[model samples]
Target chain A: MNPGELVPAMSGRAWRVPPRSLVEVIDVEGSQTGDVFAVPTDDLEDGLSNGRTFDYGESIRLTTGSVLYSRRSRPLLTIVEDEVGTHDFLWAPCSQEMYEIGYGVTEPHPNCLDNLTASLGGFGVPAATVTIAFNVFMNVAVGQDGGLAILPPATAAGQSVTFRTERELLVAVTACAATTANGGAAKPLRVRITEGAGSPTQGRA
Target chain B: MNPGELVPAMSGRAWRVPPRSLVEVIDVEGSQTGDVFAVPTDDLEDGLSNGRTFDYGESIRLTTGSVLYSRRSRPLLTIVEDEVGTHDFLWAPCSQEMYEIGYGVTEPHPNCLDNLTASLGGFGVPAATVTIAFNVFMNVAVGQDGGLAILPPATAAGQSVTFRTERELLVAVTACAATTANGGAAKPLRVRITEGAGSPTQGRA
Candidate 1:
């Protein structure tokens, strides 16, 4: 309705979106990747399931028209618009332990898991439950033999992808803090919510 | 060891395997699927990582010569033998919430998450720490666009896959309870560990 929110670089933010509303994640500054997570308003315990979405939706590269599913297979959000098509759903959210083990970083490093857990703290969600996150603008290339290559985002400045909420949902977006998918650097992201912006769905339930 | 242990249909078992020891998972009956989990005996806090393995190993369909990495990127185990080459490392461990939400099954259902949690209870590891596990004899085919297809196990009766421990590790095996990957049924699995087995590594860090 008013000014869009900005997900500061290396941080995260969470809020609710009503049914039929449109939500957009903008790559505010080029090549800055982020992670998106959704949990139904009525069921904060249940969250997004990349496995279920891939199984039911038929692909991991979710673009326009792809329906994101809750762990229960309930439709939560549908991708309605796409300015960039390559998003990663395969990798798990990065955490503090990952930095310690992978890079021997002993200092406190901001990670998606902590950012998400803290962002969802208002809902009393714990860290472990924050297991999976749909990586927005994160490029993961799957090879013929199921090999995965974590490439940099193909997104550029001002590019954004939009989604329509199938039901009232609590969503969190993070400007991914890991150096893996953000071209070795982290940056800011933008989120805009347009109330009652999309038409109701047609056809079977 | 003398007799191999049997993970009853819908249950799990845990044990420690010494370095270079050969561990085998047998599909006791044709079409049975299983889940494999490992934690360093020293650190029960950390476990396996599908994301890290897929990144370092460069493939999800791990077979002979594939080294499984821990969450911190430490090499824990290597696949020295693979009777069934097609396996899934994509899906998260099935949980009770999954059955209730996805299938509306109200009855108490055995799941990989619970089975793993209970099995690792002996080591004082909690449920939340049992985050990721590798699905053995489980078929998850990835489409060209990263879509996933859960298919029946191609493993025949008595067919098995073997792994060599890179270090002393606490390994757990479970007879998968979910039907999505087992063709709508669950069955028993077999685990056998050979002590003081296999030759040392040739060249690896």
Candidate 2:
């Protein structure tokens, strides 16, 4: 990596590490978005520090105005608005390398990395600033057996999520690990974005 | 948008497109990743003249040997392996202005388009070859009153989708959208990418 270059922000609530100035993700066709996802820009490590445990409510049990706390015992993000039904908190990001290795070098369609860079450049954010992101649409769960399982049926379609800004930050969002394993390989989804109306929604934006 | 540059093959199934191409995008987590997805190569388009839909059993969908028919009704690509649950027929690509305007610049984060350019350059893909895309993960269902309504329960986590290449191609992926409306604004998720086995789990790879 270059000295001036930065990795992209994580996809889920971890994005709160350096939370975007404003954030929004839409759920086209009966998919649910996250209710409370947040991070602290001041301490990205705190967002996803090793051995940290943040109590997450069941994706199916989430309600409006859900407050999400970080493992660091701080306010992360919140869920101010939700349409559709609920959002998933377990999906992963998509990437080109993964696509190539997972599928083959010849696999055609673009992956998440391709899309995020373009958006970053368009916003005048230097490509060098790209960092790992925190995705809000995915559903990664910890099973009772200590296994990391991405729970399905976590979200409904037409569900939207809004993240208000606590500060001016560059945020990134991607659809997710829409693979045959995750049950999103059939149809693409629709995501929309809207600004926050003063109050920060789930520490998102 | 320039013609002098060499672009990646664009296809529905992905594998049918040219190899080693590039794609660009703006937003992610905020809106649907498919809201602005694309397929830009001509040769890649010519390959998928026939329609091939991957319909896996209820537990999983997506045919590895089948091909995709792009919006232009052209052959997009082929499925190499689908470790994820399913691939979508309706996702959109990510964008920037969409985020700034739709999500409100107040707390705006990096969209897909921005991410695309950066990723392309990072991967050594010329910027000229990259182009914008249409939505891939989204669907706008028709309502009884002829109005459009968002479908619920769109995607699940741990779903991995992989495409195989019949030709060289470029690709991009983002998880964030700029739209905060519809309740998509909450927290960000985590997106990661890794290489997969060259062999396709379905058969094509």
Candidate 3:
């Protein structure tokens, strides 16, 4: 796949990934977390449910071969390739409130919640219904005492994780705006898409 | 609290808890998990978000003084008394799909998802909008390798966890229907409500 399609810093984009196709999310500038969300093209209510995925998958770590499940207990996507195996499922998309409360930012801030909602808003998924994300290149660790922390991802520049869509999926990916989540800064990413081995490249920030 | 108000096994109930009032969820028959959900009384859109609670609280364990947060980053309830400190926020409410897929049960099984939705259906929150819950008296542990398991609760018969409602809220509790969640048996629960010392006790599974 080419260097992929650019998703600007602190912004998002949505596109349709053909069923049985390969879709890769690339960390163009490393350590920038991407909030990944997918809902079936036809229905937004049945969105990614981390509760179901972890319940069925039996492991919190989603690496290669991990099948992402939906709220209705259906497989939505399969992780076929992973360069950064340590992704995060423990966080909600960052919000303006998070900035104000956690970072003491008084002004309006661009955040993944708004980005994802707006990106999928054109596709009819309302802001309230937006599901919690699967964070690409975001590292999370739970301590022996059950303390959860967001650690900087070990993903390097140009590395990527690819997925196989179980069906035609409306996928949205955002370069997360939370500085605390992405080491100490936010950067861009890319997305590459192809139908099969011989298919032309169709696909980030 | 007079043994609380009964919530039958494999079912649920919903009621308005006055702001600042003390409400207790009693695992009447012991080892029963009550899937707890709360939404602002006037707004169904802002519901329980375990992710937010854990994100801000920094721990998976909920006990006395733990405040339950809403999806919008608002505090909805506060745990004032917890006899069983190991409540769970990890698992989604059990469903028929779990019965069929995990246990090979073919019949339409009574589950906490349906029970919660049905109990709160009268309040106008559509089944599709019901959020993942905070499980009362449920024990869940994560292993060193990030393996998640549902273990039997340590709450004995008649033990209860009390909460202080931060606002007028529509609180729902269901006796979890999954046998795996409740030490291999589905059992009833109760709710006890009290305004203050010397006040009338009002409270279930």
Candidate 4:
């Protein structure tokens, strides 16, 4: 099914992407972090693993042409078109506990974990299946001394990154919980899915 | 076709592996490094990339259940079994130029690149397809300060790591030019391929 929806700032949405479909994530308002997570529609255990993706990609910085791998080390999606060159490969999805610990906030705090789980729940994906996610449009840098710093996004409004799904997938995305965690107003992000040129039953059939 | 062969130290061998096959690499001699490389049988430009594997795996160290990804971020192979838990993911295959720069050695020094290219050439694969490889049985450690140190192999003779091919692959292996690169006698390594549980034509066909 094709979907074009706006993940309002501090919120998320989940979609079922068929094989060989293209999922485009757009930074609608710019400078807003969009956390993207995916799992195979049939196997939650074989979902996207940021650690494995990083280990396989051999870099924490992703660009156009980078492949996002699943926990099983199979290609789940490929970044075919990238409008924003910088995206974060480090850092886990910010959870409510992290918000409480880092920002002294209580429940009802907007967090990625909660948003992702809520969105994915509609697809029968369990909460525990949500692990590390890609922080699109987020600019986190590593220093010469291995120190990591979170900086404002370098992407401008309307910039986007398009990923071609290599497998049938359940994808969830959040506009980020900066309203509580980073103390900034959350901005909206857009997602568009289209049919890819590759055959739907090309691989893993 | 399933084949078993020995790659002598200071030498290399290449094989064409059908999809859904397993390649078992045995460290026949203890403390010897075995360099392993692979490319899609049809495309040399899509050879294995260690950087992408590490980035996707999100770890520098690999064990059973880890995937070996190609430069295009697709799964070429998966580690199905590991007899020796330790494997080197930090350093690229040693080359003749590396020998000259690091050890003051001149030409004729056995190196992984030459061996891999020579082996792959037998199958019509060009020299340019010899990309980064996994230095199996080699021990490299990351220090607290992010420094990398190549140490002697922690694996004993007869230990092995088995990888299952996810796609049609052309695999090359070298017994490592240890004589000049590591100042040690190079020993023989064994490569054995067998059919995997997954159907041979499950993906590409």
What's model 4's lDDT at A170? 91
lDDT of 4 by residue, A1-205 (tens): 4557888878999998888888889888777888899889878756676545644455566777777876455688888888887787555677765556456778768778789989998888866556457888777654543335567887778889888888889989899887522226688889998865544433321
Candidate 4: count of backbone clashes, pairs at least 3 residues apart or interchain: 27
**Listing candidates in order, what is each one's chain A TM-score?**
0.93, 0.54, 0.92, 0.90
The worst-scoring run of ten residues by lDDT in candidate 2 chain B lies at B49-58
Each candidate: what lDDT?
Answer: 0.80, 0.35, 0.82, 0.73
The per-residue C-alpha lDDT of model 1 at residue B186 equals: 88
Write down the TM-score of every candidate.
Answer: 0.78, 0.34, 0.93, 0.51
lDDT of 3 by residue, A66-129 (tens): 8888877777888888888888777778888778877899999999889998999889886666
After superposing candidate 4 on the true structure, give the runs of residues whose Cα lies further than 4 Å from its correct spot: A1-3, A179-183, A197-205, B1-205
Return the interface RMSD of the candidates, in order shown, one decimal each.
3.7, 18.2, 1.4, 12.8
Model 1: CAPRI class: acceptable
B26 Cα displacement, candidate 1 (Å): 1.3
**Given the true complex, what DockQ would model 3 score?**
0.59
The fraction of correct interface contacts reproduced by each prediction comes to 0.49, 0.00, 0.51, 0.00
Per-residue lDDT of model 1, residues B127-152, tens digit only: 55565688899887777856677788
Angstrom error at residue A13, model 2: 18
| Model 2, TM vs. native | 0.34
What DockQ, between 0 and 1, does each candidate earn?
0.38, 0.02, 0.59, 0.03
